[model samples]
Target: MADLAHGKPGAGAALSGGHGAASRRDFLTIAGNAIAAVGAACVAWPFIDSMNPSADVLAAGAPVDIDLSHVQPGQQIVVLWRSRPIFIVNRTPDLLKTLQDTKDISLLSDPDSDVLQQPGYAKNWNRSIQPQYLVLVGICTHLGCIPSFMPQANSVSPGWLGGYFCPCHGSRYDLSGRVYSGVPAPYNLPVPPYRFVSKTVIRIGENPPDGGDFSLDSIEQI
Candidate 1:
């Protein structure tokens, strides 16, 4: 009877050992699946980040488009390209007359436009494809402060003529954005590289190869 009891106890021990081995194998399989899922998420993160816009967009020198349909006459709008502000102005008939009337020629530092200031197509008296549209950089050439637009008629203070006024140093520009002879700024505000993609759309920052440099010199010659 004692020999029979020892044999039954040994059989029970063998069954428990088999069950433990199966449980350990199942645990390892679940752990491996969790690790694989984590690895997949890590790989996907970089692709998601690449889809976002970066500083490279500014460095690439891409052109920006402005819609003129809503741009009111005598008002100006500002847009950014390559970290620079490009100002677009819709001139009233009076503003156009002011540009035409300022004919001293000698008063303008680059009156003949010898310097490369704007694109070729923008060299006209108004500095744009349409007489009412005017595009220029907002930063003052003297010290890089943004000039304030004083568009109201006779807004020019005291002896100053009507135009943009730089509060930093009291520099004055005419309605056509030509700097006064005695101002701190040596040159007129630069006209950025731009083109008219449509009647209502102006593209800034890049000039078309077929269109040429569009610099101030080119426009003056036209």
Candidate 2:
């Protein structure tokens, strides 16, 4: 004759079980929603960032101006374009002559510079319009490390006329940034597409108006 429905323990147990079930369902729903939101945020961030201009884009194809007046003779300056360092070395008259005379043409990998290391206008012995002003990309062809400009003729191994030295390995380049025969570098350091906007102002990334395989527009979009 016990009151089955009204028993205290039975009623309490039934209520507790129902509450626990509801709580678990709520937790699972909330957690799932949070996880989905996080995933969506991750996907959206990249798309948002891409809309803004990147450093490479801003600098890639833009003409970089440098003042030649401040650049001293026999010294060099490093500038950044599309995250790559470009070297502007003002060679002494003696250094220019030495680069032209001492290095044997037969020994070079690209003797006539047939490769596309430089713009069409820069395909010459010095690889620049003015012999004293040498503008070149600072990366080493061997492994892409920035080469230290060694102005002294003997800074590197003996019989080292003068040029840049890549400390990462023993790669050496002439003042024109042309690689030596036995070095690890497969080719010469690239002469970034550039033009002299004026006597003192030089642009690093853009090509001249005259047409070629590569153009200013290509670099500007970087």
The model with the greatest TM-score is 2
Candidate 2 lDDT by residue in tens digits, 1-222: 222433665464234324434554456667888999999999999999999878778756476788888998888999877667889999898888766663455566676667667777888988887787998878887887899988786778676678878889878778888777887887777777777788888877666677355642333111
lDDT of 1 by residue, 102-141 (tens): 4544566665445556666666676666778888888887
Candidate 2's displacement at residue 185, Å, is 0.5
Question: lDDT of each model, Cα atoms only?
Answer: 0.71, 0.75
Model 1: what TM-score? 0.65
Per-candidate TM vs. native?
0.65, 0.68
What number of clashing residue pairs does each candidate have, in the order they appear?
8, 4
Model 1: which ten-residue window has the lowest total lDDT?
A: 213-222
Residue pairs in candidate 1 whose N, alpha carbon or C atoms collide under 3 angstroms: 118-214, 118-215, 118-216, 119-214, 119-215, 120-214, 120-215, 123-219
RMSD list, candidates in order = 15.4, 9.8
Q: How far in Å is the alpha carbon of 18 misplaced in model 1?
A: 92
